[model samples]
Target: MNSSLLLSLAITGGLVLAAIVAYNTWTLRRNEPKKAQPPDPSAPSAPSAFGAAGMDPLLDPILRQEPSLDGDLAGSAGASPLEGLDRGQDPHDHAIDPSDALRMPAPAHMAERRPGLDPLIDVIATLTMEGVVSGDAALAAFPPTRRAGSKPFAIEGLNDATLTWETPAPGQRYRSFQAGVQLANRMGALNEIEFSEFVMKTQAFADAINAAPDFPDMLQEVARARELDQFAGDHDAQLLFVLRARQAAWSPGYLLQNAARVGFVAGSMPGRLVLPASTPGMPPVLTLGYDTQAALADDPEQSAIRDISLSLDVPQVHRSEQAFARLRDVGAALAQAMDGVLCDQNGQPLPAMAMDPIAADLELLYDQLDARDLSAGSVLARRLFS
Candidate 1:
C-alpha cells in the first residue's frame, strides 16, 4: 500500500477504538448502583410540615455534621460541642425572691382547661344535671374501670366557675358533665358490645349524679368507628431500618458506643436506646434496639450482635421535628461508624431509590391526616393512632 493509504487506515482504526472505549465506559456507568449523597449539614433543612402554621423554627433540633467513626472513638464519641458552654443560671437551683414571686401575675386559670372528650375520635354522651354538682360527687360516680372494653372511657365536667370543660377535680363545681369512649384504637374499631358497655357505664354514672344521660345512636357511632379505624390503619406508618454488621459481629458495648456518638441515649427498656424529641414529654423521635438477651447477659461485652434496628413512630412525632430526615441521617451516620449496612426488616439492602418513594408517600399521608384535622403529632392524631 502507499504510505498515505496506510496512514488513512491507521487513523480510521484509531477512531473506531476510541468510539468502542467511550461506549464501554458509558455502559459501565449506566450499570453501576447509584449512591445516595449524605445531606449537607450546613444546608437549610427541608420545610417542615408545620411551617404553614408559622411555628417557631428554633424548635427544630440543632443540626451538626455527623462525626466519622475513623476518629478517636474513646475521647468524646457522643459529647456535644456545646457541653462546656455557659448556659446561664440553673433554673432549679436559683432561688426566687419573694417580691419577684409576688410581682408575677397569677395564671388566668388552671392550665388543664381543654375538655377530654373529642367528638371526632370519641363517642360522646351528654349528661344534663338539674343543678350544679361538686367535682367530688362526679368523681365518686366515675366508673370503677376507666375503660369500655379495649377503649378508654373518660368523663369531663363543665366548670361552673371557669365555664370551661375539664376533668372533674376536688374543690371545683360543675354545671354539667360529659362522658366519652374512644371510637377506635390500634386494637380495632369500637364494636356494638363496647358501645353497650360504654352506655352502661355512663348511664350508671348519670344515675349516681342524678343527671339525664343522652347517648348517641349506637349503630351510627359503630359505623363511624369502623370508617375511622379503616383510615387509621391505611395511614399509619411505623418505619424501621435494620443495620447489619459488615464483617465482625459487634458487641453490645460497641454498638452502644457507636450509637451514642450519633445522639442515642439509653432507653427506659433494656436493649433499647432513644433519640429524644426536642420538646420535653413528647414521644422519642427514634428508637434503637438490639437483642434483649445480649443486653441482659452478665457479660454484655462478650455478646455478639450482628444486627440492630432503628425505628420511627410517625404520628407520635411532630413533622416540625423533621423526624424522618433525622432517622435517615442517624441511620447513615451509625452505619458509617459501625461498619454496617442499612437494610429492611427482611434483611434486604435499603437503597436511596427505595427511600425516596417512602418520603413522597409520607408527605401524602401527612396531607391526608391534616385534611381530616388529625395532623400528625397533634393530640388527636396521637390519640387516634394509639
Candidate 2:
C-alpha cells in the first residue's frame, strides 16, 4: 500500500465515526419528551393587594405596590395627609391616634377582627349628596327634592333621636346622646352593624383630613372651654363651636364638649377624647345639655344650647345669626380645603377652578339656608318640649 493513500483512508474513517455520533445525538433529542413550559410566574401573584388575585379591577396598580387593607382604604381618599388612621396606634384597642379624626365607631370587641368603612361612607355620602345631610333647609333650596322619607332616627345626628334616661336625682340631671337612623316616622337607634360600619368608614375619611387641622376662620373666635376641673365651678367654657370640619382639624367641639361634660367621653383615642370633670361629690352641674337625639317632626328639641346661656357672663342668644350664617358660607371653605385633593376615586382635582365654584356654591347655600319657605327643616333642629 502507498503511505499517502493509507493516511487518507484513516482520516476518512475518523470522519465517518464523527458523523455517526452526531446522527445518534440528533435522534435522541427528537425522541426525548418535550418540556411543558410553566405559566408566567407573575400571573398568579396579584390579589393580596387588589381584589382576590384573579378577581381584582385595581389589581394592576395594587400588584405594583405593597397593599394594606386599612391603609389602602385611607390612602384611597383625599389629600388629607392625616389619613393613616392606624399608623402609630394599635387598631385593636381602638387607641386613637391623636393625629386623626375622633370618629371611630363604637369600640371593637376583639382586636383580631375588623370591619370595613367603604359601605357605610358610601351610603352616608350618597345620602348626604341627596340632601339628607343638607337637612330640610337645604331641601327648600331645591323644592323638587324632598326629605328622604322619614326613617328611624339612625346616625344619632338626625332628627327623632332621643336620650330618654330617667333623671338621676336632685342637683343632678342625666342626659345622653344616642344616635338613630330614620327613613320615615319609623325611626330607631342605630343598629350595631350600621353604626360600626359608619365608624370604620368614617375613620378612613377622618384619617384623610386628620393632620391638616383646619383652624377657625381668622375672623371667628370661639372661646374653647378650659379642661374640666372638679373644684372649678367658676372655670370658663367656650361660647360656640365654629364649623371647623372644613378647615380647622381640631377635634370637633361637639365631640370634645360632650366628652368633657361626662368625664367619660366614649371614643377611639384617649388623647383626642377628653371627658368632662364630674366627681361623685363635687359634681359639675349639668347646667346645659345639647340634644343630639332625633325627635318626632312636631316634637321640638334644641340641638345646641347657647353657650352664652351656659356661660356665666352673657346669658342670652348671640342674636348675630353669624354662627348660623356660617353653615352656608363654610361649605365653600370646606370645598376649598379639599383643593389639591384628587377625587380619591379618580386621583384628580375636583371640577374646574374648584375653588371659585366652592365660593359660588356657598353663596347659593346662604340663600337656601335663609329661605323662609324651607326654614322649617333647614337646620334639622328641635327645642325640647320644656
TM-score of each: 0.71, 0.17
lDDT of model 2 at residue 284? Answer: 18
Q: In candidate 1, what are the lDDT values of residues 174-291, reduced to their tens digit?
A: 9999999999876778999999999999999999999999988999999999998877766655666788888767777677656655666666567777776766666777778788
Error of 2 at 245 (Å): 20
Report lDDT (CA) for all predictions.
Answer: 0.69, 0.24
Q: Give the runs in model 2 whose Cα sits over 4 Å from its true position.
A: 1-345, 350-352, 372-386
Report the Cα lDDT for candidate 2. Answer: 0.24
TM-score of 1: 0.71
lDDT of 1 at 268: 57
RMSD, one per candidate, in order: 18.9, 28.1
Please name the candidate that would achieve the greatest TM-score relative to the true structure: 1
lDDT, candidate 2, 165-238, per-residue tens: 22112332222112222211112112334334433433333233221112222111111111111101111111
After aligning candidate 1 to the native by TM-score, how far in Å is the CA of 125 from where it should be? 0.5
